[model samples]
Target: MAVMDDSRLAEELRLTIGRLVRTVRAVDTMPPGEAAVLGYLDRGGPLTTAEIAQQRGVSHQSAAKTVKGLLTQGLVRVEAHPDDGRKLLLTLTPAGHDRLAEERRRRADRLGRAINAVLTPDERKTLEAALPLLSRLSTHGTGE
Candidate 1:
């Protein structure tokens, strides 16, 4: 096989991955903004609206709207911040936790099936072998 330049190969790989992600079946019941908020809370625990917005890369007003919807759904609860009386901290309720877990499981199952369909056994093994490198790339700047 001819050796390709690393940058060109990486860009091609990224485009392929992007196409795969865009084509995946998503859970349509939950809006993207709400799902993002829930995912952040699931990973980082309780946070104030400002913190959530920062984590989500969204405006404060956008985060507020997402939080309002979550509150209306009884998926999140607000409490007085111990350090700051004026700002409220938001945490996922039991219902929210359960919902996020279910969503994750569903997406994992879908992805597994899709991957199995597309790749041969050897290719799948090769992809698994590259996971560590991919993870390193993912954590390079985010301080994960």
Candidate 2:
């Protein structure tokens, strides 16, 4: 196989991934910021607003606003921090988990339909084989 230029490959992958994310997210009604906070909590467990901000690389005010919106929607609950009396931690409620699961199912169905309708058998096999590489690329520098 001919080697592709590194920068060109990166740009192609970046654009493709962004498009994929947008397509998947189109089924959900939640605002991006609110959904993001919920997704972070779903993966990372309970965290303070400050921790969420730091993890997301956003300003504290931005994180706080996101958390507040989630709170208003009953998607997340805030509890007093176990180790700190003055701080609060945010966690996903049962409804939030259900919403996440439903959103995932919808996205999966949409993507699966698109793939089946558009891609050949060989292309499907190629995508199946690429899953691990894509996962690794996403986590490469995160120290996960």
Candidate 3:
């Protein structure tokens, strides 16, 4: 194996991951922002638009626009916050659940096919071994 410094490894990881994400995302049927909103709602929702913006690391305006599109598509529903009457919370609709599931299935299929096609058995093992580390790195990515 070629020697790599920390910075070099970081750069390589960042670039390769970025490209891979783009490749996987290319198969998505919905816009990324909308898909993201659905995912957030699925995971930790009944969230206000401001909370969504904070979680997504976007401006309130951007998050609101995404919410609007989701609402229009019937993927998300808004309701009054339990504690705060003035604030509204968003929840994923049944359609939203199905849509999010489909989106995940499509991306997983795309990535799984590519992984099988491109990697040898040993390489596959190595990649699987790296998954935990990658997950940790991802967690640290959220300003943790």
TM-scores, all candidates, are: 0.91, 0.92, 0.94
RMSD of each: 1.5, 1.4, 1.4
Worst 10 residues of 3 by lDDT: 135-144
Kindly report which residue stretches of model 3 are placed more than 4 angstroms away from their true locations once superposed: 141-144
Clashes of each: 0, 0, 0
Give the number of the best model, judged by lDDT: 3
Report lDDT (CA) for all predictions: 0.87, 0.89, 0.95
lDDT of 2 by residue, 63-141 (tens): 9998888888888999989998999999999988987777778888989999999999999999999999999998999
* Worst-scoring 10-residue span by lDDT in model 1: 20-29
Q: For model 3, how big is the CA root-mean-square deviation?
A: 1.4
Q: Write model 3 residue lDDT over 24-72, tens digit each, in one string.
A: 9999999999999899899886899999999889999999999999999
Best by TM-score: 3
Give me the runs in candidate 1 sitting further than 4 Å from their true place. Answer: none
Q: In angstroms, how far off is 67's CA in candidate 1?
A: 0.7
Stretches off by above 4 angstroms in model 2 are: none
